[model samples]
Target: MSATAVILQNRFSNDGATILSVAVDGRMVHESWNHTVSTNDARAQMIDAFLDLWNVYCEQGLVLYVSSRTVRNLLKEQQELFDGLLIRDTITGAMFRKTWDVCSASHHKQRREKRPLPSEIEKEPTPLVVVATDASKGKNSKTVGLSAVNSCGIIKTHEMELNSIFDAELSAINFALQQFGKNVKRLEVLTDSRQAIQYIQGRTSLQST
Candidate 1:
């Protein structure tokens, strides 16, 4: 008999934090200060908000979208209110975790842009150079093999005395940076290590700032 459903999701973080907010139809309706309320207080607010919405739309269907298992169990305890309600994503933690997994499956590698030959240039500005670096660490190997290739077809490889992959990766990055002494303002270094990229970018930004 119910024609419309009020979609709801209770979003909160931590093991015992209060419900940060109740998203009704994708809009936050009732929100509590995070970690500032007791578990009892969280439940009370949830019940209050549900009852308020139910009073207005009880004739309509109720849909619950729960992303956390703890929050789902808490709501399940109120069987009287939860009866006849529709539920989606019953016991999943970390919303969008699966979606992000799918995203990475297809977006892991980026496409490289094509460049024109040096002879086809009319007025050449600053020479653009792109350096790609990578390291190989096989099992039972003590040394790391670091290699770098530039857009100008210049390739360099080094056997570093570093034992860990991180060390080898940093050495490869340094090799790329050392390719240009000065006057090369446009330099691009591509690597598979996200941690290295983040650290180098963060340090460079902090120094510039």
Candidate 2:
């Protein structure tokens, strides 16, 4: 089986961005294209992007990143027409995991090959810090509690006032990042707020006044 992977990301309405990335040889070497779609209609933009990617990597395992559940449902409903392709809302899905693992291993191998022998100081590298953030709203009040917990058993909490739960969730993320981001090279943040994730990923946009 030929090891080929393709990733499609359609963000036309949010910022007119449409991206396609391809990798081969079980490596993360990517040949990517980014185009600014001229269309303003969200559904049309998504369909156009999907069709374009589908046409190019029809034989490869195509993975799509789209925020619209409607489009995902439509594609799911038509399984026979889009067989062999993986429709995903996030990069952590199975289709992306294999591609990502291949890329990561390739990069690490190249780095190891260039490094000197074991004559230098040998110490374990710092582990990646993973943080989970959450926010809870007070009953019949604007007060909110924001908490950030890390893998190291460290917990940080704050209480504040926010207009809505969405705001509180977003604020919690910002607070967590601010508290744990400094002087750290690698950090992973986990949150259960889908709306907050969508906002941070630029999949959902706020209306301008």
Candidate 3:
């Protein structure tokens, strides 16, 4: 596990990649590479590495800690692959500290200093800025809605109806990504349709009727 984590760290992008530490039984077993990659290819590779780490722990009957950033990225890029994966978001300083302590203890290392309060912790990690799109077919009309959110929740919702749900979902995702801008480091999209999720997963391409 240690070696696998080291390899993953090396493969991740250094500039933006979040550090991923893995441990079993309260012991630090692996720490991902320092590099950070934001491109799709990099995200795919990171997912692969994470799966490998997950399998290693599964074989040994141990639980692993995954960062919120990592979870969000995977949720966006490879939602299916992570469907049943045990993931916990370490967003609050207390949560982060607790997880960190678990990892440190796994390796027989002393726990590090705790971070500032949750309020003090930067809101940057939260997907405060988000766009959600949903589609439904009524007896005579189809409807689509676009909504925006910050830390407090939905700030705006727009209604429209495209020919298909795929169109609506894509438009919502695109709009959110655009609105959030490149400066935003994290974004979360919420949808209730499995078809939308599958479409994004590349299992099925969008088709217009």
lDDT of 1 by residue, 1-209 (tens): 43222222232345453323344443334434434346556555555666676676566666655444555576667757655665555423343334333322222211111222466444544477788999887778768898989887889888867667776777788877886423575888889987677667674332210
lDDT of 2 by residue, 1-209 (tens): 32334332344235554433333334444422344545335445556656766776667656654445777677677757975676666556464567756644544443344443576436454457789999999779999999999889899999998888889888888888898876566889999999888887889885211
Question: Would you list the rank order by lDDT, best first?
Answer: 2, 1, 3
Candidate 3: worst 10 consecutive residues by lDDT? 1-10
The collision pairs in model 1 are: none
- In the range 5-24, model 3's lDDT, one tens digit per residue, is 22122222246544445644
Which ranges in model 2 have alpha carbons more than 4 Å from their true place? 1-127, 206-209
Per-candidate clashes, comma-separated: 0, 0, 19
Candidate 1 Cα outliers beyond 4 Å, as residue runs? 1-126, 203-209
> Which model, 2 or 3, shows the larger lDDT?
2
Which scores greater on TM-score, model 1 or model 2?
2
Residue pairs with colliding backbones in model 2 are: none
**Ranked candidates (TM-score, high to low):** 2, 1, 3
lDDT-superior candidate, 1 or 2: 2
Per-candidate TM vs. native? 0.35, 0.38, 0.32
Under the 3 Å rule for N, CA and C atoms, how many clashes does model 2 have? 0
Overall lDDT per candidate, in order of appearance = 0.56, 0.64, 0.50
Q: Which 10 consecutive residues of model 1 have the lowest summed lDDT?
A: 106-115
